[model samples]
Target: MKIGKSKNLRVGEWVVAIGSPFQLRFSVTSGIVSAKGRSIPNGSDSTYVPFIQTDVAINPGNSGGPLFNLEGEVIGINSQIYTRSGGYMGVSFAIPIDYAMDVADQLKENGYVARGWLGVSIQEVTSELAEALGMEVPKGALISQIIADSPAENSGLKEEDVILFFDGEEIFYSADLPLTVGAIRPDSKVNAMVLRDGLKKTITVTVGELPKDPALAFNETQQNFLGLVVEDQINDGRRLYIEGVMVTSIDPEGLAYESGIRRGDIVYSLGRAKISNVNEFKEILSSLDQEKSTTIGISRNGNKRILSLNLSK
Candidate 1:
């Protein structure tokens, strides 16, 4: 897969899709570059996977296929299709080769993607809400919730703060925050310009790793970290009754990566919690505030291991 430069995406230019559509191997579809930097939903998290919207007939088995330019250079990867009857609805989406390649590289290397942490929950601004807040409408993400102990919280970013610029990049919407933040290196300090109470202010923030589990009990809303979910697994007789918090997934660029924990890793204890499942471990983590760190003991692939993580407050 070729990683195209972000600047190379030309509008109205010819592009091709290479994939196995309808479970057919080696299928190729042709179309033009529809748009870039488009936003799509990813459950609770908003996916900034810029849609290479095309008229191509992308179907099943077409995933991972390349969308090539007229020059045969891969511009995007055919990924998903919007359909009501489980068929292409003429609005097929391809992951921009650049973005797809980036994600693939991160996933392959680190087990998950790493994003910058701004520590704020944002929503699209509305005229009524803007009027209520006494601001302009239809622009920028509204500060709906701010995570405590986050860079924004430490830097004085308050609720209703409208982020206008991150570093030097313009933040036209909330989705831009994750993209901008994710691009920053961990522990590096960056400036964020926000609109608060009609007054513009800049705050410096130290970037942190995106967490592997958003539902992690360490904090109610802290997901900017290395992704690795593990629990204690109890073994029984021939059935080998499995009970314990077992690692389901490990994100790339996380501390767990350095620790060599992979999928199916079973965690037994975190400082004597004796975790047997996700909920059991979650119960222990629930008591931990932002200032606490948890030392973990895990069993992976039948081997025992120990790791420590200072939970980000």
Candidate 2:
């Protein structure tokens, strides 16, 4: 069967799904491509699968069935559905034929898929975060953490770097990075464009092979004397471009809470020190003078503001 070019499929384009949903044989459904490059949350991290979303009626038995264009060319494979109930909810996802074919070829050759890996964790960029980072628009994946001894670390990809392009393809969302990186052959060098400190730069990286078990370990609580409870924004399971300490709770009568800092405030910078994570927040707080007023940069609900706190009072 001829395979359609999924890359050419655009939103609102007509498509068809042929499958055996709920044990019914040769069922056919028609729909339009609803969206692309969607990132869905998976456990602690998210999977960067550029799914072709459709209103196609795909159900439990429809997985692995071909999704075709009007020309009878296969464009995708019905893979998942978005539903609160155990039935179709007008939203279904298909693995793009390009990606699926790549995996199929690799598995047929080596009995397993060898996906290229870049050792980094990333999150999506929000409009508020873009302004805070001096970016004119919210695009690309924001590197939240770099794994030690990984290709990203070896290539000098640092935390807070916004990866704009990978191998000449623009990454419109954070999820696009993994989809692009995973399709490459391991040990191949590729060019990447990244925005660092509001400046655009290009770097080369030698992609590594995916580890059998890739896991990120984080702690539950941190100890700080600032009378505020903060967590690492990036690792807290929320996809956001701004990296800093997110205030989860505040002591009602404590210095921070009394200084107009409340729950849900993201502390981006304190005085002249930039805060990227909880550790950095604690470090900066350790050096602060208890008798002086301090200036803090915070983003509250997409609005940036400056807060001055008199710790001496």
Give the Cα lDDT of each candidate.
0.63, 0.78
Q: How much RMSD separates candidate 2 from the native structure?
A: 11.0
The root-mean-square deviation over C-alpha atoms between each candidate and the true structure, in angstroms, is: 13.0, 11.0
Q: Estimate, for each residue in 188-307, the C-alpha lDDT of model 2 and write its tens digit.
A: 999999999889999998988876553221111122445666665544346776767777545545677667776667889998689998678878888999888889888775667888
Model 1's TM-score against the true structure = 0.58
Q: Per-residue lDDT for 1-313 in model 1, tens only?
A: 5456644777778777877766778876777767655554322233435576777888878876777777667777677776657687777777666665666777888797776666665655555556776675545666767777876687777887888887776776555666567656557788878778787888887777666664432242223354554323322223533346655334544665555555555667766667765567767766655466667676644557788766662
Q: After aligning candidate 2 to the native by TM-score, how far in Å is the CA of 272 from where it should be?
A: 34
Task: Score every model by TM-score.
Answer: 0.58, 0.65
